[model samples]
Target: MNNRLFLKEVDQRISQADLHKVDNAVFVLHDQLNMQVWPEWVREEKPPLVFIEAKAKGDSLPYHKKKITYVLSSMRHFAVECQQEGYPVYYYSTDQHYDDGLSDILESHPDLVLTFMTPSEWDSRERLREVKSSFGDRVKEIPNQFFFADPDAWKDNIEPGYRMEYFYRDMRKKTGYLMNGDEPEGGEWNYDEDNRESLPKGYDVPEITGVEPDDITNEVIQMVEEYHPNNFGVLDDFRYAVTREQALQLLDEFIEERLADFGPYEDAMATDEPTLFHTNLSIYLNNGLLLPWEICERAIQAYENDKAPINSVEGLVRQILGWREFVRIYYEAMMPEVRDTNFLDFDGALPELFWSGNTKMHCLQQSLKPVIEQGYSHHIQRLMVLSNFSNLTKTDPRELNKWFWLAYVDAYEWVVLPNVLGMSTFADGGILASKPYVSSGNYINKMSNYCTSCEYSVTKKTGEGACPFNYLYWNFVDEQREAFEVSGRNSFMVNMYDKKSDEDKKAIKESTNQFLNQLDRYSG
Candidate 1:
């Protein structure tokens, strides 16, 4: 009877265009099935219901209560969607407090209890596993079908040395998404080099349409206003695709409108550009509502229909087959301890302004501005900007993991964990990535306009006018030198540090502390 999860997802971030389409879609499903009430989809009389939440751990700013509101709202929405389409949904908030909900669910006496596989935090899956052992067949946890890859896919491939390039190449061969028989469509497995073009000066993005809410969404807005009055993210631009029908429209928009430029710029960043050449589709992709096969089919159909170029089609498919699939598989292949792997052994808490966007660092401010306005950021902003800063500053993996999960509109643990802890922070020891994506102000400067407007100096390594990222980056490297040595990619860094004077190194340490102590200043 509690179907709020599904409904809230629809209510938040659903475009006005898609709202009409979703309404029509729900009507079609209603007419086609000649039925209503989601629980009816439990054709087996009992479906071993699953309760889901894409939430942050909330060890830092904005606190955990705000997270509960977002996930609880979304889960409630999903529940409503299921009830409308004929399925049983039993959900709890995606928070530190799922135990009581789990206990309540246990009392429901389901044939099985289920949860999505996660690589970010161990407690979620571990708790579910314990629940399963006690309940046996009555608690079967399944890999979330939201992702495109099989859960075991990453585990299945073990070459002489495990690497993403090899896996990506293999995927290209198997799926033929951008393949010309045995040849890759772009003559390469990746177009990352071609994708790094920065947003040109004064280049304006077109005025885009936003998703408006339906009755269910309006109800969620009411709930947001009443039940959880202090959620951190903005509620104004809430337009997430929560239902199967609406999710399709999002898929279609990406295919017809943005897919053409998606591949080359998937990694690029722009200060004024949020969507840019990228599709803000991860929200739909992470949720169970959006099926990967259908998305792939649409991209493939676009190419076959001659509507989009091969570069475009290949780029779209690569994310599904390469990055997205790889993340899920990579997450399952290594976990439990992976969540605990803090390469830098970073123990500091997350900053206060991550929630408030009150920082002086221009990159942090602008990157966060959109997050405040729309509750989203492209992958690079998540990985390079936010995650990169956390890594450089040596923020605790646990804290960063929570921030990644809670702060973004698109974040769900299954997708965010490996990307945050493993890939972004190197907290998982290279199971998800071969090396930590640690970088300094220089890299951000090259890719974004954030550094251009910031108070910090991108070129300075320490002291006055120094970019916080610069000092923090060096400090993190020096502290974690032993750990990075194990990665085998730290030779250049080691050499660089070895050549530096002890005085310079001492200065770097002081500068990092200076930043950390004044976290409130930078955070705001």
Candidate 2:
């Protein structure tokens, strides 16, 4: 046979083998949960399984190409591992709706009983419910084992008001992490106050030895490049841990090297150093290569072994057990409505600089550059730099949320909704955050080195060279003063703004208006 005909024959033989292997058992795997961390019940069955990595339709938003490659490559790697472990794997890569891909698989195997872990996102869960309705007794859904906290329990225990601190304290007690028999080990639930110090001058930032993409990942990169040419991020330098072994290795590296100072500089930003002391394990954790409990316990063990400090260990644990879990629960509790919220009613368009990183604003350019290149940015850069600019510029919360959903490798609806719409934009009306996370250029100047070489002057509050954030922040406060005055959490901000002189306020408003009017000029 010719080369093309020989390849076709090989493909046909593989398809025949896959078909013969199909049995009465089926497990549907989503892209996010791309690991073999299934429960005991799932392990009891040694049967053919299905994993779908569908290029979802109707998403006009430009997703980061690196994000797509990471998920697809990780899923493909996990499917290969499953096949090697004696499970017949039917991995589908289709540019169609997820439902269509799943339906085709189910239709092909009439005798197969479907089993799936409940999805993390509401929309996916609802779609699965519809599938379950069709399959009836043949379909079964197990509770997702990826989370340390139970969603139902979270919903039940939550009181009239939602507070992450209370939930975090409860989680600490439940898990015995940093706990000393009914009390926290450090005598406090949070070490966040000590965790906010900026990176000291001349301190050497540890270099992260990220996993090099293997043959499977290289193929995935080529696939994404050909299929998703217009995607938001660059595809080169796609270094992510696509397997459980590699994920664990990355985690070990973080615990041994970076965790020592991760606490003190967790919120700090630098001009060229994106990761700094931050753990880049979120991509692995979110994708299910690493479990949250395992990561949290490992960090705690690092503290016990004196490899890392209490503040560092506690901070890391709190993020996984506290904020991560809290945001997930919050997403589930308030979704369908949370997705539509716009408490401040700001309906501005997202700037093109968010995609191109071509703006003169140094902090934004610095933050967006990494995101555009790597589909990765530390949490501080996301919140303080990127999301803060979006909020202050009056960008629509929904648009910002979509942008985040498309941009970050770690982005998922469950995490991004609460972080962007609730915490960043205050769009959920204090559901997730007490106040808006808007800040002037002073915070950026204090936390980062970006301002030192910026085109805009951090000191100038108005006119040509003034930092956009300085005036835009005041403008946001002015526009939303009535809403801020009503809430005890934000009333102080309004009072502070009210204390500003009329001249300063007018200059701020004028500068903000001028900048807002000329946003298109700066954008791509």
- Per-candidate TM vs. native? 0.77, 0.94
Q: Which residues of candidate 2, in runs, are more than 4 Å off?
A: 1-23, 31-36, 57-61, 156-160, 521-524
Q: RMSD in Å for candidate 1, one decimal?
A: 7.4
Candidates' RMSD to native: 7.4, 3.2
- Per-residue alpha-carbon lDDT of model 1 for 1-524, expressed as tens digits? 23345344543433212121111111111101112222333343533234433333333345333233434444555556555544434434444434444545555534333333332235555765665576565443433334445666566663224766777788778776667899887577676666666666775454344566656656656655664556566666565554556666777777777777666566667776877867676665554456566777788888888887666666677677777777766666665556666766778777777778888888888778787767777778878788888777667877878777767766756567778876788776665666678788888888777787778889888998999888888887777776567667675787797789999989998998988877752233
The superposed Cα distance between candidate 2 and the true structure at residue 210, in angstroms, equals 2.7
The worst-scoring run of ten residues by lDDT in candidate 2 lies at 1-10
CA shift of 442, model 2, Å: 0.8
lDDT of 2 by residue, 1-524 (tens): 01121123223323322644455555555444543567654567666667666666424456789887787777767767766676676666555656666667677767667777788877778877787888787678888878888887786653335689999998999888898999998688888888989888899987888778877777777767777898888988877788888989988898888999999999999879999999899988887888898899889998888888888999998889999999988877787878999998988888878877889998998899889999989999999988899888888888889889999998888999989987888887776777788889999999988899899999988888999999998888888876565468778888888899999998988898888888862233
